[model samples]
Target: MLDLAYDLPAPKVIRGALHDWELVIGLEVHAQVSSKAKLFSGASTRFGAEPNSNVAFVDAGMPGMLPVINEGCVALAVKTGLGLKAQINLRSAFDRKNYFYPDLPQGYQISQLYHPIVGEGEVIVDMAPGVARRVRIERIHLEQDAGKSIHDMDPHMSFVDLNRTGVALMEIVSRPDIRGPEEAAAYVGKLRQILRYLGTCDGNMQNGNMRADVNVSVCRPGDYEKYQESQDFRHLGTRCEIKNMNSMRFIQQAIDVEARRQIAILEDGGSVVQETRLYDPDKGETRSMRSKEEAHDYRYFPDPDLLPLEIEQGFVDEIAASLPELPDEKKARFVTEFGLTEYDASVLTADVTNAAYFEEVARGRDGKLAANWVINELFGRLKKDDRAITDSPVSAGQLGKIVGLISSDAISGKIGKDLFEIVYTEGGDPEEIVEARGMKQVTDTSAIEAAVDEIIAANPAQVEKAKQNPKLAGWFVGQVMKATGGKANPKAVNEIVAAKLG
Candidate 1:
């Protein structure tokens, strides 16, 4: 029932020599499963370890070693499938995808082919306000990751790091529904966010923990509409694949360049070749890696060593029950329950840690005030210091306490900010910082009035101007604030200033 009418841009028709060209894109996103052990071995799945230090005999594929499926990895996979709203295949099996790579210790990689763990899902990617495109998910399969190939170790020699070998990965395959490069990147991002929320993946792109393979092709404009109506893929053009994109910016660039390249080739009375391509970030163009390989080329077959995976409905239900609130649902709750604006809620709930911190600060306190401070003041300072919420100088408890003081008029906004600085820098109770620095609000009406009178007398011309133009009353407010040494409650100061001006 989620409205997707606003999410997609109107399709633009393309005219090429053969037909009006439409780009058909699918994606295969690889997300490393969050687990301490490798998929088939007890070897540590730690990153940045010394080369081969974390490898076990099984990971190295020594003689007489048998593969064992990690139960934790399976659980994580189910959690991910549920998060994607995918159908969990209770009887998924593993197959060997035969391939040759310097880093693959095993001659054949174990992957899901015949039956995948997840099936038929959809991701709603919001590109702009009131506009979202639903990218259909074909399948998500669990597989063992191969080791990394480091070609830069030496000019002549390529070194293989087996530490990452047999690490579990969730290969999420999307249908060819994405129309443009930006949509592809957005789809990947939303997938990453969902996986992270499900606790299945860390969603880290830099450490090779996550990556996307973009499949792009172009056909005539009306062709896509025809394909949508009939569900015929041939209605679109033959697509080529771009492999292992880690950066979002590069993803967009790759799609744009590839689309244009295909368009130009067809325009020049040439045919577009279906191939695996690599994006050169420096040159901002895609170069051919090799001719696209069909599924038969991999020689996929059932693995003789491992048995098919099966799980009980109870297990899946348990994972679902334990799931945390997802980003979209949490954003909505932040707006409804916390009385926060949609923008504020979205910003706070972008990350789990930030959302948790905000919730803790909002508990039993003014939601709007806590949201304002967290988003504007605290988050702004965190950005300036390049610190994450987990590493914040001020704890959620401390922030809540500080806001409480401000709410009760125990401290003026200026004094509260000063106290916040002291607490952030010195690491102490908010009340103690206020007490030690004499940073309480001047709530006494008599004291505030006397300060206001002095300010009005000193700024007589400004007061005269204020009497004529009510908008100019802010000038007197500023004077009163300055006269009271910024200790007077800002709300009370405004009222006193207005009365004096009148």
Candidate 2:
């Protein structure tokens, strides 16, 4: 059981003709397991292969093709369960989910229904600095994915591609704790971050490697609390499952539209129906696909071809020992160790590669300074170029050297930026470039004072006005820095200008 006292943002209220309604949302995320072969065959799991070239005998559901389980996929699922802080079931069974589709050669999906591999887990979704929502995981079951039915190739006849058939998937289902569109999206994003950090799934939605089935419903205010206490579905309104949303933006939009649709129906004296719906991105609305099916509708039964899966306690222990530092832990460490704000720590730890690069730059240096440079300077430049951190032209070492120069006051912040450009485009050591170009700051008191005196003499009227208004003294400082070609130390220039003016 999860603590219900955690702070969640206010529910998104939809105004109806009679009363306001709130959104209740849950998610079923299908994540493709990271593996080299199919779950029950030796076929390659590589993406973008020739239409059916990666299909094996069992994947095509041929006669006398007995299914053999792939151990790698099971191990990845166990790793994911451990990463989620979930209970890993040592003994689990596979069931046949009866379904018929053109792309489903076997006519049934091998899934875990009664006995799942993972049990209850919790995901702490950070809404703001100190606000979070705890979304509970109902279960994570292993299943085989169906293939694709391509209709765009030929209008008269559709085509079936079996490359994706039999690929392992972990259906991570969450309870109805999400309150709004934004919260729903954040829940999915947080889950994706964890899965990516665990190296269980790539979480690539564009390639169809990961997608979500969003269950959305609208209830009157105070009904959510009643449902929380009673643990009954009556308090929550009837839910409609939106199928296969691949994009985060689309997921949020779909939920909002669906909630409003439900609200409008109930306000118009129409009771909401339980069913499955599909979201049309361009249309920005959901249309009915089919009536929601109960468990018996699928005719689920245990598979006799494969025996129940049983693993030793030592197996779970070994996998637990090998778990990596997850995103939340890493973010907390970044905030504590680096003295960074929660926002900065979250941004830096969003991606594993980004966090690693930042650590390398911050090692043995001022962490706050290093974070500023890495987040603002490096990340801004990379975004402008449409480049990932792994593909960055500026290496961590070079960026660290630039930050070191700025910290040591060897170069002004302005000069540091200039040095950054030279090193980024021309590819040279930051220190060498600073030395070769003579771009060091003009920290010598005599040089700065002479420059300040010359500026004051050239502008006598401005100097008199500056004496009356000390704030206007910045005029002389700017002029001196401009006179020195922006290489003069700003602190030194300010001090000399203020003394001479006084």
Instruction: Give me the candidate number with maximum lDDT.
Output: 2
Candidate 2: list runs displaced more than 4 Å: 1-5
lDDT of 1 by residue, 1-502 (tens): 2233644434434465556556678899999999999888888999998998989887887888899999999999988888888899899999999999888877889999889989988898877644678888999999999888989979999898888889999999998888877787888888887777777899999998999998888877677878879999887777889999998889888888898889989788888888999999898889999999888999999998999898999999998899888887887788889898777887887788889999998998889999999999899999999998889999999999999998899987777788788878989989877777777788898898998888777777877788888998887777777776788888888888777777
With a 3 Å backbone cut-off (N, CA, C), the pairs that clash in candidate 2 are none
Model 2 residue 266 lDDT?
A: 92
Report how far off residue 113 is in candidate 2 (Å): 0.3
| lDDT value, candidate 2, whole model | 0.92
Candidate 2 lDDT for residue 362: 93
**TM-score of the candidate numbered 1?**
0.94
Superposition error at 59 for model 1 (Å): 2.3
The whole-model lDDT of each prediction reads 0.86, 0.92
